[model samples]
Target chain A: MVPSEAKKYLSKEQFIHQAFSYLEKGVEPTVKTLWLNDEIQEKITEILEHSYPKLRLRYWQHDDQTVWFLDEIGKERPISFGISVKSQRINLVKVLEFRESRGGEIHMQAFTEQFDQIKLTDDNKLNKHIDGITGATMSVSAMKKIARVALMLDKEVR
Target chain B: MKFKLALVSAALLACGTVNAAEPTNQELLDLIKSQQKEIENLKKSVEEADEKAEASVEAAEKTMSNAADSKLSFGGYGELHYNNIEDKESIDFHRFVTFMGYEFNEDIRFFSELEVEHSLSGDGKPGEVELEQAYVEIDVTDATSIKSGLFLVPVGILNETHEPPTFYGVERNPVEKNIIPSTWWEAGAGVTTELAAGITADFAIHSGLEVPNDGGVYDFNIRSGRQKVAKANADSFAYTARIKYTAIPGLELAASIQHQTDLTQGVLNADANLYTAHAIYNVDGFGIRALYAGWDVDSEQAELAGQDKQDGFFVEPSYRFNDEFGVFARYSEWDNVAGNSIDTEMEQTNVGFNYWPHQNVVFKFDLERRDGAQDGDGFNLGVGYQF
Candidate 1:
């Protein structure tokens, strides 16, 4: 079930609007939103724990979408965020875009592929992993970490 | 004349002087028509002459452009490496590479590579100058093209991917070179293409001729004293193909196969075949790679009976501390199948750091440990650029 307080957050249109507004504010937002219930959230949290041992996620609910942001405690500039959802049988994870210097555009395709393989269960982490592209390794890796954070966010926000 | 006419008019006034003026309306009209005809002829002649002059100027410009193009372009890439080895020879090698490309037209281009290896050797006793690659390429489209000439065999990572900065080490891994051959270029022709959704592939036919010169020998045909004085056949051919997939972000997998017939162009031809599978994965600051390659050679002059096969494997792990600096390590091992050589097995470890102050250039230092049967067991450091 969706949370009662989730309605206070932005809808899809409002979310897109706010995202652009935040970008214009000079704040690089790493955002992730997904749909999930409590039990799947717990399983996803376990998956993310292995993926991102150093990160903890904070999130909020807004009608149908679960909005999550990666909170960087000590860093400035070049922050990334992502979101994952687990409902019944399907699990989805996505990195909600970030800015990279120059060749960042080349990294997008590989990042998309990495997110598609986000599995919220440790029963097959190695089997589901992929080798990075020759030049886009860093961006792809950063996105993977953000996806993990998003999966963790699902557990807490739910 | 006018006074006489007036006198006669007054006497004949007398007569019909007034009726004489109306005699010929037709004659006055004909006089005006003749002047118009002369003006029209002049205008037509002027227009035709102007057109001829314009055509001549256009022809001259085209001729000049063709003369200037002559189908030529200049490009090259080089690397300098520095390294510290564990207990033996350390390596310091610098390479200066230059190539001249000539476009025969939209369909054909000729290319050649001239490299100064270990330039520090200086003057007479210094490093050698080698002709690394020479070939002609035909572009069918932006997505597909064919190249024939001397080229790197498409067997392993180092053969086709030998851009200095593309790999981790100051030099290529030992397994890659001993098993797959480094700086390997031969006469061949092949097709390379990119399909819809970003699938890339290359297929080529290469000359299986190997020059018997040392790695540092520049002009194989010109050099006098060298081991294995056999020249590469002008007509030997080999076949190669590589297929790659990028279905996932930050990940790519590729496989390559190559076959060369005999060491020379002759019947009962000796032949060599190589196969490889390689993959790379990236997650943020970290990268991981694994590759395997195998080679098989068939020759009646058995260098080693049943020892005509060689194979190897390698793995590399790397991390970028930040954008400008990174560290990487690699491990590899190879077994030589040529039974005639004293060196049969080789293993090596390489650790290196790279600094890229700019995108197109890099400075690198590599230290390696080799417990192998080759004089190449030393370390290498290099700096290379691409533009």
Candidate 2:
């Protein structure tokens, strides 16, 4: 890849780098794409309180191990974010694109880094605590939903 | 399994013919090395193809999202109200509003709100259709924007975001309506910017109020001074400035000031200024809101009419049991004729509840008590929604 091309959208590139950085040397990662079935779609809708239009998701895996689950969510508009899971625990969370006028603060590393090492509880909720940003409640809620969905999908695909 | 068996049989035969026709150890090692090299080449090709496929999907998703983002967006809010007072009972569909917005590009866009009030409009009906806001906004930078055309003045909290389902109460708080003069808009151009983290500032220059000097029923009702950009008189201009701080979670504090050079449009020697301050605290399911607003009119004519120095304040606290149920209480006091030698204070208290069937729909009920010269009690019911 060209170095100059990577600078075009820095946030997106940064997320990609972080996702792949967890891999061992010479381990080739491949993409795994899935379509939203009725059950998955219903759970997502319940969490978001709104139905999403697109029906497909793409994740990355290395040597049969799920590495990252990437998706976009909407508060007022779509926010591109990703989650990385290792041994059933979240290793990293990153916000790739933030389009809303408010809640851009959710993209800050200080906020997203808190999701690291979190696991799903018995009730399928996030086990670790997350702090919310002021005036960005909707955006923060969307991020939490994304994290839950990612954890669930990791279990299913494995 | 079949390949492994074949290799074992060949190796046994070679061992049996050690001195006869048999492969050398160096040749066997060379063959194994060649096979490993081929496998590595195949893996490299596969990885490259996978990388290309991922990049293609990413590009496609980006293109689709960009197209969707550029599409025209539509939403709106409306409300119906029923008022039962000591002297009369009335039911009215107070407002039907529609919002339309279009993005010309990433940096420029148009937004508008069209509203119909009182549910009807005719030769003898008491209703009208109006444009509450229509503005073209240009992003000057990531943190600043400039807007021009008819827009709500940045003097009050509800003026910009008063969708029915968002606020708490059956009817709007009287303090905002009577003193700050909400639902207020005018022809104007303005700039809004983030002054710091969680702090915002706005300034606007707009067509000023044009209070008629005919000494009629609306002579002292400051709420009636709004021209609403309808062939508005522009003999003199108005300037408004506001600052809001929300750096703390669950707390917002704001202040606004507005000055009109000629409240009477040069018809009477009158100039007016308004000051307003408010705070809203919302945490968990508990909330509190308080506001104080006052107006000062500098004119001999206004003073004679007892219309100078009008002021009011209100405090409201509410609790939500859950997403769908909440209750609140409020106390308000005001006097539009405060300059009069005889006291004209009007004090009121209200208790209310809101039932939300959905996040976008609400049913509201409230009971109110009014004391002073126009002492009375009333009940209000309202249903409202946004989409």
For candidate 1 chain A, which ten residues in a row score worst on lDDT? A1-10
lDDT tens digits, residues A52-85, model 2?
Answer: 4555677777653455444444334567676777
What TM-score would chain A of each candidate receive against the reference chain A?
A: 0.44, 0.81
lDDT of 1 by residue, B1-387 (tens): 999998986987655665667648688788768878888888888888888866775575456345323445565668765554544554445678876766565556666777788875457756877777777766576456677766656655566555565667777776666666666666657887766443678887755644233334231111121111136554556678899766565566889887766543464356667788988776676888788887666764433343456678899999976557889999887775534456667777778788887544788876677767543445666777753
TM-score of 2: 0.79
Please list the residue runs of candidate 1 whose C-alpha ends up more than 4 Å from where it truly belongs after superposition: A1-158, B1-74, B83-92, B100-111, B120-126, B210-231, B264-268, B303-306, B338-343, B372-381
Best by TM-score: 2
Could you report the DockQ of all the candidates, in the order they appear? 0.11, 0.14
lDDT of 2 at B225: 86
- Fnat of candidates, each listed: 0.28, 0.06
In CAPRI terms, model 2 is classed as incorrect
Each candidate's TM vs. the true structure?
0.53, 0.79
